[model samples]
Target: MEPNNEKSIGVQLTWPIKQSSRVPTPATPQAEDQKIEQGSSKKRKTSDIWNHFTKIKDGATTKAICLNCSATLSAQSNAGTNHLWRHYHRCKSEPRQSVLVPRNSQSLPELIRPPKFNQEAMQECLVEMIVAHQYPFSMVEHRSFREFISALQPKFKMIDQATLQTECMNLYKKRKAVISKQFDDHPSKIALTLEHWSSLDTSSFLKISAHYINPQWKLISRTIAFRLLPPPVDANVIVECITDVLEDWKLLNKCGSITAESSNSNDLAVNKICEMLKERQLLKSTDDYFHVRCAAGAMKEIVQEAFKTTQEAISKLRRIVHLVTATEASKASLQEVAGNCGLPSNKLPSRDILSRWDSTYSMISDALNFQLAFEYLQATQPEYLDCPTALEWLQLKTLKEALEVFHESVSSLSKTDLPSANRSYLNMKKIERHLSKPEHYENNHSINIICPMANAFQKYWARLREFSEIASVLDPRLKLQYLQFSLVKQHGVLVAGEKLTISKNRLICPTIPQLRV
Candidate 1:
């Protein structure tokens, strides 16, 4: 070959091997019984070598101390390391001598509450609010949202890094698929373009958004309180201040002032819709048509106002949940909110959110019944459940559980508020009469038994008409003037009054359940 100087002068062409910079570590050998003994390893005690407990208290052993650590043991005393090992896992520290404290031992008192103010005293209200007999926020809390927003004065003047972080803290991080700055909100099928911003009053979705995403809102003691009356001098003074503001809103937004002063003064705008819903033709005519141009605006206003109570209730439930993960001090503040509204106050369910939990609690018996069904299915026809997709199975399971929960809950809550539970129960009874046996517990989860649940109030009203006497015994809270509940067998209802009884049925001599001596 020709003496190719270009090839000869070229650098050597060879594949370079690159090795990792990691050092290989050899495996550790297992410790032997002899090697793990004394003498050569005298510095480390035999017990310490194997760590065969710090010290032993044979209950009648010689008094001894673990020199390796500060643990102690005594022959006559139970304050020894041996006694403590049972709880050492939960002590949150190194093992030490321990003494058993009886859970309810009254003589040698452990801890008790101070009179009015204590670390735990602050939690009393919160726990109660979380587990109250009824959730108050669901009833009166929404009023606070508007009042608080109107009350708060945004702190733009002196935005500290902390305050700025807080404001930015709640900012949602949404990313577009193309990673653009703008958000694309899909339009509804019946879209109505607005001429002005005010044309879009608060809609149901907007109310939901406002609950969490208000730039003006601030967390007072971790409870989201819209900055009403500006940021007060003391951030800690928020609970009581916000409480007063909300209370005022409730008083001002009195249901009494809603209706016009006419012959039918009793009928408020909201009540009118409630009545019109029964008259499907009137409701659909007005709702479906009634000025297509102004339809969205009117519908938004109608929905927001008519179901103001429902919206408010949902918001209150939401606020109660926000403070669920707060300090004892902050929890006390939440309790004030709960107290203003009726809700459970203790043993708060550990769930995703307070509102969902409150809603869940409102349907406790439904949850329990669901659990029972789950167990029953597992024991019997697990494959019937497995055949469905995970999500489908869960949905069906949850629905079944909800039914059971509603059924049991109405039965229990019935005794306290007859009108309310009576209505709820009658709905269940309708499902029972039409789709189930006399006892609903039997074959409720049959694949074939699927029917739309009857509305409790609808069933209640029907029942009320059945038993005219029922209305007389109904509670004032249920608006008993024309209250109702469905009954068992035939097409009729049991009504509530001061004296409860069944109203309509084939039975000529009708009588409510009675206890005669």
Candidate 2:
């Protein structure tokens, strides 16, 4: 069988060899010379004219064909190669090469490398700027912006509004995919923060963010969802939306806690989510312990409540600010007076919104800063009678100092790099100490004003979750001893002893050993 296979392969190979066999044809000398010249293009021999001409047999005579212009000439041995050289020199289609050599003749300028421009990179940068700054898509089409870009780089082609929108969508999808992969790779439980925002047109959006510590110990916060909530956004609707977001991101079972503003709807939503997690056997803590209230939101409520009791003096200050900023002439007069009073003219009067106490604080702060300027205006102009009396000013000073404490605490908690839960108790303690001080109140009016404020502060501070207490204990600076001391200072020794024992029990519990500094 092997011998037969070898014979069959030999027969198949010989078939093509037999088919290619043909009788040789005689060739002319000039054609033979042309073949040799074509083969030796790298190292020329004989005349250089052969480099641009090829010998060919036309019937009984031989001729030369120009490679450049494709012209024909005589190639008989009797006629030398002179005509070929003349035609090669005069060939209009031939390419020219200019060489540069050294000697003291005029030399060409040295080539300087210009900065390289990448159109795709510039497009990416433009898309990033638009997304980061929230610029309109039509900004690229504006005549002035285009002119500015053209001046900066003339080679860049400006994209249209539709093209820019497409680029932005592509960038958003790419970044979202990257973040989704990160979430998938993250190992620890993710904490969530959610908020509901409304625009000027009354459209509401729910922005949900995921927070987690990566393997490198860096805290990362990424917005996972910004979805429109339809009308009648009740607790059920919020829960369903949050569940969809969690399931969509594949984070339903991995979520540890949720932070949101203190409200009935959010509370019910958290309860529903906890039930879902428990069904999957993922929740180890109760729902009450899992819900973390927004510290900033709680402080806002405290400040607004404090603002209500002191509206009389605030209204007088608001009227004076309104008077000074009513017109350009009045602003100029105030600026002049503020300069003469040795205060910053840039700290001019500012108006405040009724709903935002922070702005009210700003209005009061600016007014107090320019108190002397206001008094000067009151003495010079009879129309300026809105300045508060000395007692009211003193009350405003006391109120400012008290509000400053809350402001500092909120500012500290809003930072993202540090642990906020651990510091929340400490900040609350600072506020409690400030409110409890009798030296801060000078008169009956001051006492009456501070009493309501203190009540407001305590109302929110009492509702803090057990997580804050545990977190405070985890802090190296304020260990279990400090927490015990703090509890005894606030609550009596008996109550504080019970609370301290409970915290210690949780810390030493084997099932909940995940808690660490």
**Predicted structure with the largest lDDT when compared to the true one:** 2
Q: Could you tell me the TM-score of candidate 1?
A: 0.17
lDDT of 1: 0.30
Per-model tally of clashing residue pairs: 47, 0
How do all models score by TM-score?
0.17, 0.71
Model 2: residue 124 alpha-carbon error in angstroms: 3.1
The parts of candidate 1 lying over 4 Å away from their true place are 1-185, 189-286, 289-436, 440-517
Model 1: per-residue Cα lDDT over 1-517, one tens digit each = 2122333432222211123233211111122223334576545222111131243556557544433344554523334233333222233333222434333334343455222334333333333443345443332235554355335423212223343334333331221122111112211111111111111332111010001111332211111123332232232232233334324332211111111111121123234432333254322322211111121122122222212323333333333334343457645543444444444434432323331232433433232323333333335543323222334334444344434534443445335422221243334344345434443334444222222233332333342333323322333444333334322224344323222332322122322221000
lDDT of each: 0.30, 0.76
Q: Which stretches of candidate 2 lie over 4 Å from their true place?
A: 1-122, 143-158, 285-287, 336-346, 379-382, 389-391, 485-498, 509-517
Candidates in order: C-alpha RMSD to true structure: 30.3, 12.7
